[model samples]
Target: MFKTLADWLAFDVFGLTAESSMGESVHFFIMDITKIFFMLVTIIYIMGLFRSFVSPEKVRTYIQGKSKFAARVLAIVLGAVTPFCSCSSVPLFIGFVEAGIPLGVTFSFLIASPMINEIAVVMLWGMVGWKITALYVASGMVVAFFGGIIMEKFKPERWVEDYVWKIQMGEVQAIEQDNSLPARHRYAFGEVKEIVGRIWKWVIVGVGLGALFHGYFPENWAASLGDANNWLAVPMSVLIGVPLYSNAVGVIPLAEAMLLKGVALGTTLSFMMSIAAISLPELLILRKVIQWQALALFTAIVTVSIMLVGWFFNIIV
Candidate 1:
């Protein structure tokens, strides 16, 4: 159905020759843009509704006072489900700290929140394969879990901003009650509009880049540089991805393009993970909450964890 529509739009509507590169690129752009935005709107709305039921205060309460192991686990799970973006990381971090959630556990949530989101999972499942999506989720959870534990062992509480520790949220409270069904639906729609509106441009840009690569880029270029035999490819990809910031949805299409050009799955995934999880923008956001030393440690931990995941996947996959 989708292919037929794309074909009709490209050949009949646009009058592009069916087998031409321009025609293929347009078809891919149209199909991917349609499929991705549909999934983004639908999934983000549902997740937002889920978010409505679970407030930040509740999250703080749930993770506070738990054993380290249990707290880390719960934090990872909560982070995976939360709907916030990297731009909201500092506020969330402050909230967690004020709620008496441990710094390490908060780190777990922070790392997992942007790295392993609903849109990333849904898009990976739709555009990539289920096995790849499953692997991405599992690896992300592991990175969060161990990264939190390592940070806790180092005991970097002093590295947190003194202001963060002083701020308190005792007076603030979660919603007194849930909104009416109509209100809830309206809120969900609002969330969909906000999130989709924010990301639709990036999505289009990503798909455009992907389509360009799919139709015009030289196939052997990435293959030569990022082939499995090149040990430096994984780390190089991670290093390159760290400075660039984009959500998983924005970067996945480019990653898909790389894979089609014969980049190893591990290298491509590592690039996407680094872009989503440890970008320069996130680092700058976190700087407000954590001292330089702690920020360096956090970056080191996540970078090393991502590199290991990349190498492991390259070997096994």
Candidate 2:
């Protein structure tokens, strides 16, 4: 009975034949669907752990009276750890303002939090090489740091909400823990459900985008991008990626597909970083934090940094 059941479980339900084109199409569709589901479950679950475990409020207190440079460095480190989203960015921005951190320093944390979190790094490492993955983290942090500095030079105090100046200082609330084993388990499960539930749509969208690139795009895309022939790919890719927004997990599959399709590594990396850092989603969300002028400065700084990253990576790799 055990042997028979094992055989049954191993059998393909759709009866796709290995040698047939029709069977191959079915298999591809099934695999893409599975990947989409996996991306949703994995990405959001990780974010849930971040929400439940890490506290950005704690970070806000430490930057008090510190050098902007130090805060920027800390921002990069914090950004790597915190699981902030578009919704959360505002409160954090408010917290920074209430704390009297430099304008640029505040921008540093705000910029870093959503663009390059730990979840993205882990996903990048899993999907791409450690070298490329490391580059993503390092460059993202630098972008956040300098991007904030550039924004500070403009000094858009008018962009801040009038109410932020009146906010009284207070400690941030920490996550609650349960003493009972069952309750602890429930808390963990709840985190997963909450995180995954929110961004699951993005999973389907991202994987679907990746699948399109995988199935239909020219096979030589990455290779052509990878080749050092034209210097034009760097700026062109950056120009294209600016209005797009993708979390690291979403972009990893796209990057894999691009690489498979002969997309240039530098160009692809630039595109991924631009979408992650300087995209429309971030801009729209940032509008709630700072006015249009500041937002433009922020975008310009991030775009230039990403463009440089693309060119630098292309030259080195």
Q: Against the unseen true structure, what C-alpha lDDT does each candidate score? A: 0.84, 0.70
Which number leads on TM-score?
1
In candidate 2, stretches whose alpha carbon ends up further than 4 angstroms from where it belongs are 1-52, 170-176, 220-223
- In TM-score terms, candidate 1 sits at 0.92
Question: In candidate 1, which residue ranges exceed 4 Å CA deviation?
Answer: 17-19
Q: How far is 174's C-alpha from truth in model 1 (Å)?
A: 3.8
Which residue pairs does candidate 2 place in steric collision? 221-261, 221-262, 221-263, 222-261, 222-262, 222-263, 223-262, 225-264, 226-264
TM values, all candidates: 0.92, 0.83
Model 1 Cα RMSD, Å? 2.0
RMSD to truth, every model: 2.0, 4.4
- The sequence of per-residue lDDT tens digits that candidate 1 reaches over residues 206-260 is 8998888877777677777567878799899899988877778998888777887
Candidate with best lDDT: 1
Query: What is the per-residue lDDT of model 2 for residues 203-299, given as tens digits with 9 covering 90 to 100?
Result: 5566667756766565566556667566788888888888766665666667766766777677888888887776576677768767888888777
